[model samples]
Target: MNLKDEKILSAWEEKQSITGVHKITGYNWQQIAKVLSTYGIVANDTHEIILNLYDRGKNAKEISKITGYAETTVHAYLPRVRPAYNENISENAKRIKKYRQNK
Candidate 1:
């Protein structure tokens, strides 16, 4: 997907609520959710908050602060989450590198 679509997905993931995402993106939440389905992302599962936060760019320390989970516990859960935390981090790094190159 292009940057705009990525941003929309990012916003959706960050908000973690259909209405919240819809309000910001001005797109129907269902449509946004459909896009998420295509990406294998299932939004708004409370049990997945840690994983979701990780996907939205929160590190173990950050997630720990937000979720009251210990940093080590967050680290433990990272591997169980889809895409793996390290892989997600690498992908983010690549995105940032490409973005910088474009700039």
Candidate 2:
């Protein structure tokens, strides 16, 4: 790993009270969390706080504004609740495909 990633890993390993990697690297907090997740990091109180903030009416931008999270992090944690977000187009594949093929 590069020096930056090494530092990020150090921060996670230390489990410091708050995210310290963001201050010294291009990595954002969410990106750090994503890395932690990739390595099987368990959920913690901070994760719960993120979930709670996302569950409220606040949009990602609003969550970012209220919380200290980066804008990207707020967005990363706050999608997938809308009907459009959950929509699936693969459900009617057979009928749709037959009609299209006949045409």
Candidate 3:
């Protein structure tokens, strides 16, 4: 259960969940949990993983696909996940347009 294992460390840095790391590395949950504990990397729960994925620029739909949550559920959690979440797609578009124009 060494954090020095490059494959595991890379997955952790990518914010992959324990299950994801397991899938990638063929490690069981216990081994992954041990590594997590040894390295003080708190295992991310579902809610936190969703937020982390969002923070990494995944949209609700994408998060839904990754997490097996419905799109509506992802949408429902998003605002609570981050304060000042702009649900207005058009507003974001306008801001992006303006920024690009200025640039």
Candidate 4:
């Protein structure tokens, strides 16, 4: 690969957002993504990357920063990838319902 392609690949491998890399390299995200795909580097969606990072113990705020998404958006996706989070919410709801019935 040429130096420009190499730089784009390096930035992508480093987990930098496409938009962020584009800002630094002056190439649009589509161009960068096309180069990555050409080299067999499958690009993942921002949500999927966020979920993986969350599984790795990164919080919503940190994931938001890395993925260039709002913290609220990251939090919204957490339940989809984190079964434990959904379970906890369900358990809390059950407990609240039981408490109200008992009272």
Report, for every candidate in turn, its global Cα lDDT versus the true structure: 0.66, 0.57, 0.65, 0.67
Q: State the lDDT of candidate 1 residue by residue for 46-70, as single tens digits.
A: 3267678978998889999999867
Which residue pairs clash in candidate 4? none
Return the candidate ranking by lDDT, descending: 4, 1, 3, 2
Model 4 over residues 1-103: C-alpha lDDT tens digits?
Answer: 5677788887776756777677678887656755654565545675467668977999989998888888866664454332322244577788998899999
Report the lDDT tens digits of candidate 2 across residue range 12-93.
6665422565664557765666545434453466555666766576666777777787887655444333333223446577
Candidate 2: stretches off by over 4 Å: 1-42, 82-103
lDDT, candidate 2, residue 61? Answer: 77
- Backbone N/Cα/C clashes per model: 0, 0, 0, 0
Best candidate per TM-score, number? 4
Q: Per-residue lDDT for 55-102 in model 3, tens only?
A: 799998999999998886566445333222343457778889799999
Off by over 4 Å in 4: 46-103
Best-performing candidate as measured by lDDT? 4
What are the candidates' C-alpha RMSDs? 12.7, 9.9, 15.0, 15.3
Question: What are the runs in model 1 whose C-alpha is more than 4 Å off?
Answer: 44-103
Between prediction 3 and prediction 4, the one with superior lDDT is 4
Which rank order by TM-score, best down to worst?
Answer: 4, 1, 3, 2
TM-score of each: 0.38, 0.36, 0.37, 0.38
| Model 3 C-alpha lDDT versus the unseen true structure | 0.65
- With candidate 1 superimposed using the best TM-score fit, by how many Å does residue 77's alpha carbon deviate from the native? 26
